[model samples]
Target: MSTQPTTDVAPSPPAPSEGGRPSDGLQAGLKNRHLSMIAIGGVIGAGLFVGSGSGIAAAGPAILLSYALVGALVVCVMRMLGEMAAAYPSSGSFSAYADRALGRWAGFSIGWLYWFFWVVVLAVEATAGAKILEGWIPAVPQWGWALIVMLVLTATNLASVASYGEFEFWFAGIKVVAIAAFVVIGLLAVFGVLPGAHSDTAGVANLTAHGGFMPHGPGSVLTGILMVVFSFMGSEIVTLAAGESENPQRAVSKATNSVIWRIAVFYLGSIFIVVSLLPWNSPSIVDDGSYVAALNTIGIPHAGEVMNVIVLTAVLSCLNSGLYTASRMAFSLGERGDAPKAFARTSARGVPRAAILSSVLFGFIAVFFNYKWPDTVFAFLLNSSGAVALFVWLVIAFAQLRMRAMILRDDPSKLVVRMWLFPYLTWATIGMISFVLVYMLTDPDGRQQVILSLLAAAVVVGIALVRDRLRASRPATASAGGVRDSAEGEESLPTGS
Candidate 1:
């Protein structure tokens, strides 16, 4: 198979700028505030609202440490990516960086895999959002809500990038305020300060009183890690969105540098209060789910209804980001000739209309899978794509390691948002990712999904290798009397020519 590096030079072929729009299509419309909120909103998803209950149940309060561990690793990966992004910002983000620092195959494989990951995520979020909306308005079927949600977000994306930014900013802002309020209310209830509050159930003792922090033992910590990683998947979108900012470098640096604290405050801090106010093994905790249970425990009025709205918002936000990320990745692949050229075309508003439509269409199909085959097809889709989080994380680590050296070699000044401890931290992050993948193999629930995801990744990589070989084997030129080479490597020239 041909593995030519994308950066390898073979005579200049004139600039693509002549006929096509500049490589920065549709992205130039995003503003700074839109970017800042997207970074925040991307990290807080339905996982935080709903799935945290399972993690808390499994790991007890020690789930906080699980989130912290994963958060630290993400910080390292994002920092490395931010440094590279600042030096050479592009819509492709890691894929473009991989092409520059790694090779064509690396770019082709990771770009497609990342695109697959987000498209599946788009469907998952849509299904989740539909369920909540259906719960509120029972007259509409779940599938109907899913269609409406997908169509609405598709319209938002088909508009200018600025429209998307504005929509996401408010959507994300509401969730942020809700979580912040939860933290405050939970703290007051814990301290016996709020009216109608009960304090008998508060404090760190809740961590060990139920069954010790490792209630299910250290093995369950791995299980918790599996769930925890999914929540962190959207954090990388900041680096991707940063490419469109007026000052790409500053946007990346700011987002990467602050991720550590954001995780601490949003994920760990909120979970800490949840477990503090109630025993980890409480039936209500599992029955009502973590966030609702915590809110109900503090006697907060309308806690369930309030959190339902928040969770729904989180799901819609994820769907919006998923569609945006997937379409942008497809657009990048088209520009690099790895995908159909039509996906590369952009509207006057800079929106990648074809790419957006394609992603939304798949999302609509996934909603069908959710309704028609929730037990089989939907489960398989969830499991197969589950392992993609690890795969994408691994690619980010490798891309950063290679890109960092090139950036430092060419221009050291671009190291403003540098990773700590250089190669050691980078290698360490890779080790952690490897450990997570290995642990997935041993876990009963995650094993099949991990294997399926690995198989999917392998298939994509194989296709990339075969495509490279075919391109490499083709004749260099059909002109200059260089006839097509035949079976024995002999040129067959036209008799007249």
Candidate 2:
């Protein structure tokens, strides 16, 4: 099979100025430290704190295998993504790669779907954060809190890319410190080294006792995958963000290389402590929530309140990143002529002011639906975007398969971050993603998400296809004279009309 793409590839936008603060494009304002912390912190989402309780209850200690399995999947996908990102270094990330490797239609479809996913995320995280703030101060209604939180983060994103990085650095810093402390403290209690303990079950015995590790059986472990898989959505944000860093390729390569340890430490490590601290079936696991329950079991004071503070920080971090990510994707789409031109323009500080505001405007609308129509409209929005992460990963895998050969044929030196096992592992990733999507049909909730998400994808793909057909039918005189200008080395367009 030919690895070369059959369709014409659009050129990449002009490179940022040498000053690293380009007025025409995004600025390289993110420091190495900012990128480092973002890579470290991106994997630690609020879902780990709030949603793991159900997974633990459903899969028992075996949930660790679920995390490990999904972690392995993400690692592979990121490797493939890193390979292309290192070579191309675009804000579009996989979407841009898809444009050159597959076709513009593929890029348009996945890019819009991904943007939809994050804007929906904006609403979900806003509500989550608002609830916490309301709890802290009842005088302010939850709706008011949501508006306040959204405005603050929107302002942060609009300030400059560096401001976003700085805020995320601290936000991610808090999450990292909190999780590290939890693991260290939990380990002390687990090994019986702590001065005081609330539960004697804080030992390895908790793993085997109460129906053994696989309490609900292997089937339950498969089901648990559905629960924990979405928590890994933000793992790819660093790749998109790399375009705004001082050294995009190096930042991307480093972040990709480190994903394994980050997941192993933050996700698997934290979950290990929770299950080990108490029986998986313990009421605390569900009642108090996983992390909070584990803390209480170890005689921690005000466990719920402590976990609340940490979860709130995680929520805010997610909101901050969601806005930044969605805007960047919109900016990339606009640059490629797939969206309005205003989206591609930047302010004096290299901020995509129109792009940021447009993305936030949609996020605000989603938030309104969330408050006004929680069950119907918001529910539809959530389910429709639910499976987008897997879709993005699948597109990335396919894009990498073609991109690897394209890079080898063009400039092999740019292959700084290569995927392991080449076509074999890439095929395996595609297979795994397909399996997850197919498996979703078995669970009622998962089935709805799969169906609606597919519907949403079909709509976007339909639009892209229609646009392509219309462009093709235009007079040759108008469409001719195109030139090959892609930094990624895509082929040239037709001659002038």
Candidate 3:
């Protein structure tokens, strides 16, 4: 989410501002169009294209229930965030809310942990995108393609928010249209309306035919939950993007309010058509990946190549958003004095050049890891960042609980995107996330990953606590004296100051 100024509070220290260098003298260069597309694109991700296969395998046709359950949780979480974001609207989004509602420690922990998660994800997506490109051009090598993709995206992000948004808008538009077309064709095939279609394998019976709806039993549904939850991770990017928006409050409200229908159509709707067009137990699903296999079963020509192109687009889109999110989160941290002030500086177009460069550097390092020590480096990166989704979601829930009370006390009328059932539903969502985390611990496949992720969270939280202690122990003289003013004086102010 984009960052907003603190409301009705004394101005805090100004970290380096974006939009231009300290001497270049420019203002925040983000525009409304950039914000809107970022918000929309945030909700669609590569996971939807790639991860649904694992989910379907785990829960069979009943995977619909898993999506519905997770979708409901996301809607509730986003609504809670929307209410707080509309009132406060900072680029830090939930992290800032955590600071105000919970404590400085909560904000520091969540913000840094989230930033870490996305940077790692940037490497993952770049690798995935590179693998796809390598398939088309065998001579380039996967690691080389990974490096090239990261550099190109980093350049786009460093250019301007508008440039990044424009790129993402087209990327997201392609994925959205592709999914819609898939649903349409699948529905036609299910109803036996496609010209000369001879397959007898289409209809609702596909949901229950092979060993009934819960083929793997109720236990597997929990497994399905694990696969589905990650798909929802990108949806929260809207709140962060909203912070930079011209009308942050409105942007948050619209994005949060619209998320439900988007989930319904893009997620539930697409999966429904897939299952309806082919039996849940069909060999094609596990053999060819879910969506591609479904299309191929219906005799769609070039199904493999077609799906590969769509998946490639989805991967590239994810890589683009990952870079943008990592930079913005770093920028937010710098603004709050939680990170180096250099990260707070922006380019001529309001791009946080330092932060963007920092994230890209990590992405480059990851490409090296992919080439030199794929087993250890990539595995560690994956395991360490596994639980971030739960951590972030929990922060959102806690932030909303306090933000709701603050809104009620100050200006209840501003609660335009309130979560349903308020505190009750909020608590329930927390419980649900907690349950998922616990389930992850018990599942053998997820246990080590969860443990590693928890360790990463612990490390960040420890750093935050140490930082807070150091800040508290400092002599009041340093804070009250001219130390701050001297620092400010050494740096040239942005233009328009």
TM-scores for all candidates? 0.90, 0.93, 0.90
Ranking of models by lDDT: 2, 1, 3
lDDT of 2 by residue, 13-61 (tens): 6443332211226667899999999999999999999999999999999
lDDT of each: 0.76, 0.86, 0.76
Error of 1 at 327 (Å): 0.4
Per-residue CA lDDT of model 1 for 1-497, tens digit only, reads 01222231221111122111123444456677888888777779888988888888888877887888888878887787777766666677788677656666777788888888888888888888888898889999888898899889899988778877888898899989998998888878777787888657777788888888888887776678887887888887877776556666677777877888788889988999999999988887778989898888877779889888999888888888899899888877776667777776677666778889988887777777877898899788777788887777788788888777766676676567777888899899999999989888888877998898988888888988887688679766453334221111121111111
Q: Tell me the tens digit of each residue's lDDT in model 3 across 156-233.
A: 887777777788878887888898898888888888898765678888888999888889998877888888888888
Q: What residue pairs clash in candidate 2, if any at all? A: 480-495, 481-495, 481-496
The lowest-lDDT stretch of 10 consecutive residues in candidate 1 is: 488-497
Report the Cα lDDT for candidate 3: 0.76
lDDT of prediction 2: 0.86
Model 1: which residue pairs collide?
26-350
Candidate number with the higher TM-score (2 or 3): 2
